[model samples]
Target: MDVDFRSGCPIAATLDLVGDRWTLVILRDMLNGKSRYSHFLDSPERITTNVLADRLAKMEAAGLVTATLYSKRPPRREYRLTAKGRDLRPTVQAMCRWANTHIPGTWTPPADFMADKPG
Candidate 1:
């Protein structure tokens, strides 16, 4: 399968990879050390199981995340961010900061929410 490009712009190309709404949320959760499905489900947005599964599959295909089996009894899997995915931290952080500043709200994340980590 091939990607359908919206435009020749690099931003559009980048979004083609991480464009889906669920994908970014999944990435955000992974950045915050959320590795398990249950933990992802406990997130503020409360993603549905089917959507979560689909997003995981897509992320895995895009080399953004990797899944490892943590259990054999029920065949459970845990996901972690790959180096490529970790590189998205800056983009996500910038977007979050922009939203916080432009969008009207008294909400703010913790000081270390976007700390300098060697990812």
Candidate 2:
């Protein structure tokens, strides 16, 4: 929606939305089929609950993900990536490629994940 972008630069604007330390990591997890809050918490990154909550809210606000109510008693929601978010698949894949090539000790993603076409 109405993002207070720092400049008109495309890269800057994108970075503004996702350049934070945890957003991309969270995005990666989502792409890997982790949607529930507990699932995100189960990531090896060990993101704190507060930060995870904030990131999910920000992602929903950015139209990158949609939150759907899945439970009522204690009230819980599951998140699914919108087209905008799924579009980042190639970016993540590229990052993985780069890491696997340039970085030491980086594990390769599953073949299916690397082969999946980005939206």
Candidate 3:
């Protein structure tokens, strides 16, 4: 991914990579053990197929996830987070914490999920 960083700021550069609307959500789904394409489609946010495809490709290009071919006839692949991607666990957890604290009606995440140590 030949990214043009908007600035030298860490947050801005980080956002340049994963700041998009669907990236974090997809990361959250992966952290929650959703790896297959169909599993991602089952997410509550209802991400469209095209968007999902684009995100997965971009993530793979960015080295956050690895796509392994699981089926030859159907040409299906399974995605797994790399160590770089797993490092975002705390970020996702922090978001969950903020939401549960400040956003009314937000569902509290499972205890295990909230307590899991970042890789």
Candidate 4:
């Protein structure tokens, strides 16, 4: 299915592709080195299997992620971010910084965490 963009603006175009909470969460997990299905499923946030599966497929279709079969016997697949997905690190970091600054709590990410990392 084809999904039309929200507007001609670059940021709007990007949100059209990678928008939605689950999609962004999945991308964040992938950026942090969570590739396996179980790793994503076992996250403390507890995303449902169907939602995870849908997000993975959508990300793959959008060229943000690649699915690879790590096991030949059972044909198990793992998801990894492509260059397009990796390029979104700045957007994610910017969102996190904004949240940290605007939100009520004085929440600060770890030193080595991506939110604190240099672009």
How many pairs collide in each candidate, listed in order? 0, 0, 0, 0
Clashing pairs in 2: none
Per-residue lDDT of candidate 1, residues 71-112 (tens digit) = 999989999999999999989888889989899883565556
lDDT score for candidate 3 against the true structure: 0.92
Best by lDDT: 3
Q: Better model by TM-score, 1 or 2?
A: 2
TM-score of each: 0.88, 0.94, 0.95, 0.84
Inter-residue clash pairs, candidate 4: none
Candidate 4 per-residue C-alpha lDDT over 31-66 given as tens digits, one digit per residue, 9 for 90 to 100? 777898999997777999999989899889888999
Please list all clashing residue pairs in model 1, or write none if there are none: none
Arranged by lDDT with the best first, the candidates are: 3, 2, 1, 4
lDDT of 2 at 113: 77
- The parts of candidate 3 lying over 4 Å away from their true place are none
Model 4 steric clash total: 0
Which of 1 and 2 is ahead in lDDT?
2
Which regions of candidate 1 deviate over 4 angstroms? 1-8
| TM-score for candidate 4, residues paired by index | 0.84
Query: For candidate 4, which ten residues in a row score worst on lDDT?
Result: 110-119
